[model samples]
Target chain A: MSRQRSMEKILASEFVSIGELVRLSGCRYSTLKFYTEEGMLPFKQEQENLTRRFPREETLVKIKEIQDLKKQGHSIPEIKERLAKKM
Target chain B: MKELSFAQNFSVIALNAQDSLHLTTAKKVFLRCMAAATILELYLDNGFKTEGDFLILNQEDLNSPEISRYHKAVLKTLFSKKETLSEQLPQYLKKVTKLSKKMLKEVEHAFAVALTEANALEEIPALLGCDLEYVTAGISMKEYRSNSELFSRLTESLRAETLETGPMTDEAILMLWLLRESGCIHDFFSREELKRVAERIFELQGSSSLAKQVFPITIHKTIEMGIKNFLKSKKDVMSTASGSGINFVFPVIERSQSVFIDTEKVFANKEERLRDIKARLESKGHIFTVIREGEVPLIKIDNVLYEAVPSAKLYRIPVHGVRLRKYPLSL
Candidate 1:
């Protein structure tokens, strides 16, 4: 199936692409990528291109949490440690 | 016929604009959408500060819940069926907020562009109306026999639709534009009065009324009719928890143009009042030659010939050498 068809096939419940992630999160791709690499933001690495896609409601909730921590002036490492320790 | 005369006690909109700049619901919503779109465009263009390897939002951004929610809402509105590298081009933003990609139906990207591109606030609703032609193009895609026919039909429809919307009489929108144009942030209880004054300035600046020695009656009458029309138009009812209206001025344009609004041409008597103004101005080294035009006398001040409008602002001038008037513009 074509990309458009596949996108149409997936319910609204499915995770969207990294570019869409950038849009929804209002964050840069490289930032999200770095965060993903450092196990900061939650995501699934599926598909042939190993492209990142996030669950709809989960991404929003997680992003809000990350935003709250960031507002408190927590660095990426500290955020990682805090989120990691919580997990 | 247009006429020019030395204006005394001309109406003031600058300083007065602070007390009355209020945006109606529809105007406020459209402006909010435009601001959000501009911010989104800036973000997509990587215009923010570079945080080492990653891009951060604005350095000064508080990233508070309110702003975050706003960003989230804008982001959620932006969706694409297929991923393309050039989809979010910063400069090529004309069609960036296309209808198909919009998750929310009401968040019009075209409206955003039209608003951002409009030099005057009056043109926003009109341009948005023009943009509606493009929006309806999808609907009439099969109706038109040719592309030219399609465009002509669309223009015709949009023109009619915009007229039906009656944006010309929407004072809230017009007042917002006047507020921005006059460099005022706050609006007042006397906002209608301010708009009337600003409109006169535009008319006076225009070539249509250039060098014309007209009565304050002519200017005031035209503006009065316009204000009445705006007042009669339907008010935009927006459902937001925002304040009633702007209560502060950004730069606070000073009340420079002193007014003495003469309803009965009482100042037109011009025996003592005019002499007082003349004597005071002459003493202050401001020389002016008075000329009689029609029934009323005209005076030249700073080379601009104007007839005075009586108001409370020009109260310092001694009326009968004793300041006999108990109230402004009453005697």
Candidate 2:
């Protein structure tokens, strides 16, 4: 296996599973994945398993902040940029 | 069982009474109205407008051996001999009807239906004199008059009781019951139940669909109470965006139809009242075009036309003891 791929598997092992992320974030699965795909939320993929994981602390805080911004009627792209600035 | 519109069924019973039953015109109309109310109660109890609903009004369907005999038995009670010395419907019906022993259980079921409808009517004070007594007694409802005068009193009492109990009002309870009166839906977990349903109507509706946002309750809340009191916890009077001030309408009886709109509670602004009335009427599937005749605005509900009563927001229909006059049925 490539060294970079090996590192990703180890990194993914440290991150929270999708189920745990959903519980902590209070957001739905598709929603969380969408945010992650848009690069708005931090997540990792285990190289061989193809399983996704959320970097627990940062992802939860980011999602909660995103939800607050959403309630304030911020659009998705706007939320992504705003969170990027905060990070 | 054959499918007959509510209007047709009402007309059939009225004609039956007027011609063969030896009922006076007034008595005939009343008999028709009471029969309509009983059928509507059946329709509502089964989830209004659902298939297999007990809406077939033909005598043949009422007595059809294939259908549940209990429903037939109830229909017989509605159409049977007029005079009875006994106030008790079951005893009186038992003596007169010549059904076989095999159908006795179904007859018992029909009696159960009468009991349930009577109990429901009693709970709502306003629904009192829709003439259930005469109809249940196998007599004529037209002998009595419609009881619309008690509107203000019934509304006041309902409101007082409602405000006293928040998030669980009488009207709200009735609203859910109104929405799902059919005993078909016994367990109440609105969202989850919808998910389990094959068609999934709950999700299909828009997010703000009042039906969805309002009716959800914990399973315990439902299981703790009887079906009558199931959605009492989801309290909110369902009102239209305009026209009527609140969501209370009284029944105006007809042969096979009962129409209700609180003309008395017309919205303060005439324009708003017009808007509200049109919106409410249209939402309930009535077809009418608002127009000015001789500079006076009017709403035509089928053949019986209505112009606003001068000074009040209510329609200018003659009411007898709060019941809409029989001649031109608003229904």
Candidate 3:
């Protein structure tokens, strides 16, 4: 019934690939890769195929937070600092 | 049985007459409706199709219920299916739409003329929000009596052209012709005034060129003439003073006697010689200045000084007559 719960259900039902995530998030594929490389986002690599995958719901939330911080004029270092504080 | 046959024949004749009349009227109405529809189609294609598309209906469509109703249905259907209407409709529909408009208007006018007493014709113009005056103003009343007459002339002129040439093209041509004939094109400016302005510009350009060529020479000539005139005036003044008994005396002691010489005659002769020299200087426009001491005078000519004694003797002297150097002269 809640908006967040409904979004989580949709994400769990859909197997959104990296390309789909880029399209949905409106972020560049290289930017997403950089985020994963920088440990800004948590992702997984398939054992046999070596393809990168992300938990759709968690990645979407993290992307939304990052976008919000950018809109608030936060520098990447500031964002990392805030993320570290959260951790 | 014979009377029954006659009645049947009469009925047949009546039916034929009615059918012919209906067909004629229906054809006219159908044409007008088609014209109105075509206009609406044009408006839509041109992107001006709006809620007031019905305003394009001709006089006949407004007058005849059958025609007006048919036009209304067509418009409704057209607009409903506008999203799917083929772009080619405008091309194909132009001729039929024009023909229909002409037929409908002709029938409506005829009907109005026939049923004058019923005032049926007046209602049609009123419904279309047009009067004879309004329609006349829309057309060139000087050239044509009615809208149909104007349109016919247009059609005749453009008969060879394709339907892609719109009605506006003809109207634009008519306007251009009228404007040309009325001499309205000359309202911009008079050609004679423009010519005069051009001439003035050329004259100014020539004057500037002449000024540029001759200005420095004129200034140099002016300075030279001024200096020559000043020198001539000074020489003339000196000559006049020498001739008017304004005596310039220079004292002389004879070196042979070591005493004053009886030089009155020599002084007079020296005065005459000085007068002659001053006259020559004046004629040649030579400039000089005179320096005077007690009973002696020195004349400066071109920055060189000359001393004249009472006798017929003269000598070149220094500028201030200090006698730094001297040259004796022949009498």
Candidate 4:
């Protein structure tokens, strides 16, 4: 599977770094950090490493869902509650 | 965050609580100030020289990357015919009107971009409608409140009693003048305080670095006179059109599509009506050509020619509760 697959396919199989998430979502790095801290987005990190990795497709969808809730005039806490219930 | 220019800052201050542009008398004045301030910025940079009554462009300064697109558009307008005298300010405005509006739109977009970069405003393309051409975003309530506070600070800074200090900064003077000319001064000052505010503005004008440049003041006055004359002429024509000779004050709706202008408001005089229609169409994103075939102004929209007139039939739009007349250019 590794030998036949393209680099993009291999990369998409695993989690994406913060920068990749920023590029994919068109969101600022700080906003991603905020979402992570608020528990609206989930991330994984390796032992003894500082880098944060987000599940690419799920994070992108969650960002859109949060923004849609915001457009509907939801507060941050309310958005968190809604996302919690949805999850 | 990138620091905004005085003109850009003026736009932020003029925005209403919802972050949308407030289409008021202040908007007209703001447009004029944006033009004046951009020209003055170029003048300060030695890109334009005042020769007697005309402002002659220095073509060498036109290519600098530091010069903003708004400034460059103003420079390009001045470059045509090599110079723009005080008397020609109205025509100069007409040529640069579209670019000036784009500049206004750019301010909001630029501010939104800056906010997103700082992570203050959220930039979700799907929800916020961010696209290739426009980068719209959602402003947090916190940011909105901060903006309101900033506007209050600006208002407080210009209080008549606060002018005990002798000389004001150049930006302050320009902002003061913009506020006063826009009739927004009434919003911030009482009748008694207005007299003092006017005095302070006059004093500031005489002392500011802009006054030393000369042509900016000339440009402001010429534009002011041009507006006065245009309004006076419109009033005379409108009164004449009424047949009762009573001057009916027409409400100027900000959105052109929802405009409820009376058919009688359309002047019988072709030239006058042509000017009014031309302005109305241009505001709705239609471009006009300089060449007028015969008496009618030729309006070109996306390579098609169409005459715009308000239809006679009035129907009720329950949403706005105002009578809607279909403007044919939109059809």
Candidate 5:
């Protein structure tokens, strides 16, 4: 399927790209990358391009969780540690 | 015998004149008179022949107090020269006429001062009127009714829809410019006033729910207007504020409302009526956020999530989510 079709498919079916995830969450690319590296996110890793794609529902929930943590005054490291504990 | 008597009278007169003359005396007196006449002529030509003429002259005029004193000294010197010039009346008269011309020239300076003052007085009223007109025009934006007539033609040229999308009305831009020009933006708006105006405008627009979205714009405008007015009043505060490196903090949350809420109400009930919520919050561990120094009641609360309804009733729901969202609290 074309990229547009793939995006539609993700919107219609399951997952979205890292870039689209950043735009939707209003979070920075580096922050998303950090979350991904820290295992704060659940995503499918492409072995060929090393690209990450996240399930839309799970990504949104994680983003909300991050926001909640921020509101609770948890620093990024602390939030990452909590997420690690949860994992 | 009668002819002899006439000749004797003439001889007496001549003798008296000769006694008064000290060689150059006549010439000096004549020159002084000529100088006076020349000055008078200049004054007349300038239409400043009367006492008003003296007022017209600048500091340089011979009639001015300073110049007059100098002229008096020169007159005394001329009188002393009289004795030396008396032997030749014509020569003395010539010198006097030349001195009068120079004196008149100096006296004419008063006319210039008078004219300048007159011009300034005449222009001041008109200038003041123009300034008031500019300010009035600036205050009335094109969106405002009073400005309709002024901006009607421009609106017609562009069409209403295009004009709205194009750029801000010139009046709005000019208002900003005038505020900037007046230099009042900082001091005129006390932190309280900025917050007040911002809140008022937001309330008026029913945008209280979008506090975050509305604050920056409202505060910016409030600051602009405040600074403009402050500059108009103090005229020097702008420079002081700029030099002192002052930065104003306009919190996104309205501080004015915080004063009335109880100290224990901020976090008490996340979703409940105001009074009940306050009671519940106090029961819990919620604490008021102190905003102002020494003001026990000045506290910050999440107004968006929670709001006051009827008497002793606070609702902990977004305004849109509430059953009735009429604002400004009509009693």
Candidate 6:
């Protein structure tokens, strides 16, 4: 299938790109990327181009957890450690 | 002549010069900007701070005489929530917008009262058949005409490539920021001038120690980011929000027709198509006089006035005066 068709298939499965995730979550692109890079959120990367696609449900839940932890005065490293323990 | 708070200045500008400023922004977007401006005003007063992307109230300053009871109440509401007020800037902005919706009438009243006290408010006649108070209906307008000099200065500053020399006033910068957030900046500057104006606005914003102290980025950039996200979600709503109404500013013709233009057309461009329309009409022994020409051109045929959009095949019709939408006008 073409890239467009593949993207549509992923979208049908509720897998979202970073841009779509930003729209869904109302978070800034930079903030989301930070979360992704910190391993606070999980994603699958396409080997062809390394394009990251996130499972929308899992990503949103993880984002909520991170936000709640941040509000409670946890730093990024602490939150990462906490999530690692949970995993 | 007197200084106004950021929200107050926004109200004065938005309400006073809606048409002259071409404020065709959706009411929701306007309300969001008002909310953001109000929040920024409090931020400047050191009433709130950011914890990560979330907003946290400075509890000690809740009782400060500088903060209004309405503002204090909003702060208290956020403070009482055990959880953070929002997950991020855009969500935070959306929360405050609820206050704007609730207090819009109060805001209008307060600003109107201020303008009246300043001897700056003049009540224009209400539209015919609209039996409503100026506050409720927006039928009657109260233009605050005394701030002409201030208006000129703000417009001139936007047009200039650099921030005006010396310390730019906080109120001035805040008003400019609010204008940009409300999306009225486009009406004030052409597409070419907008890029330069946007840069100058950032430079002006950067010069403000107060804003730098309050926000990680300057308040303008923070609000701009939030507004971008907000607008992205609101694109569909905004495109349809312009109401159909006859504007008193333009000559209205009783009769009109809607025409659809071919997307792929023999006309090279909009201007060429408009020229062709004029030629065709004139050749039919009808007098086609161009009144004002731009993206939407106002033309007079024989004796009737009509506004025509070049992209739309609408050759002539009595203008309903609604803003020409981005989509082609089809009937």
- Residue-level lDDT of model 4, residues B1-331, one tens digit each, is 3345555555455433222333233344455555655654454444545565455555666677777656665555545565434433334434334445555455445444543454334321121111101211332211122244334434554442223233444555656655644445565677877787767666645665453433243223446446744654553343233411222123232122122222224234555455555454444343345334334344443333433332232235211111122223332
Q: Tens digits of per-residue lDDT for model 2 on B16-105?
A: 212222333233222323332333334434312223312233445544454343345545654455421222222222232233333333
**All candidates' lDDT scores?**
0.34, 0.37, 0.35, 0.47, 0.34, 0.50
Question: Which stretches in model 6 have alpha-carbon errors above 4 Å?
Answer: A1-87, B18-28, B49-55, B58-61, B69-91, B98-100, B119-122, B127-146, B157-174, B199-331
RMSD of each: 27.4, 21.9, 45.8, 19.5, 36.4, 21.8
Q: Lowest-scoring 10 consecutive residues by lDDT in candidate 5 chain A?
A: A1-10
Which predicted model would earn the best lDDT? 6
Better of 3 and 5 by DockQ: 3
Q: Give the share of true interchain contacts found in each model.
A: 0.00, 0.00, 0.00, 0.00, 0.00, 0.00
Going through the candidates in order, their DockQ values are: 0.01, 0.01, 0.01, 0.01, 0.01, 0.01
Q: What docking class should model 4 receive?
A: incorrect
**Chain B vs. true chain B: TM-score for each candidate?**
0.21, 0.24, 0.18, 0.45, 0.13, 0.47
lDDT of 6 by residue, B43-139 (tens): 5554556677565655676677878644554455444545334344445445544543345444444455665565544343211111112223443
TM-scores of all models? 0.23, 0.24, 0.19, 0.38, 0.23, 0.40
Candidate 4 vs candidate 5: the DockQ winner is: 4
Off by over 4 Å in 5: A1-9, A48-50, B1-331
Assess candidate 4 and give its TM-score to the true structure: 0.38
Candidate 3 runs further than 4 Å off: A1-15, B1-331
Candidate 2: segments with Cα more than 4 A from true spot: A1-15, A71-74, A85-87, B1-261, B265-331
- lDDT minimum window of 10 residues, candidate 5 chain B: B120-129
Lowest-scoring 10 consecutive residues by lDDT in candidate 6 chain B?
Answer: B126-135
**In TM-score terms, which candidate is top?**
6
Q: Which stretches of candidate 4 lie over 4 Å from their true place?
A: A1-87, B15-28, B45-56, B81-146, B160-162, B204-331
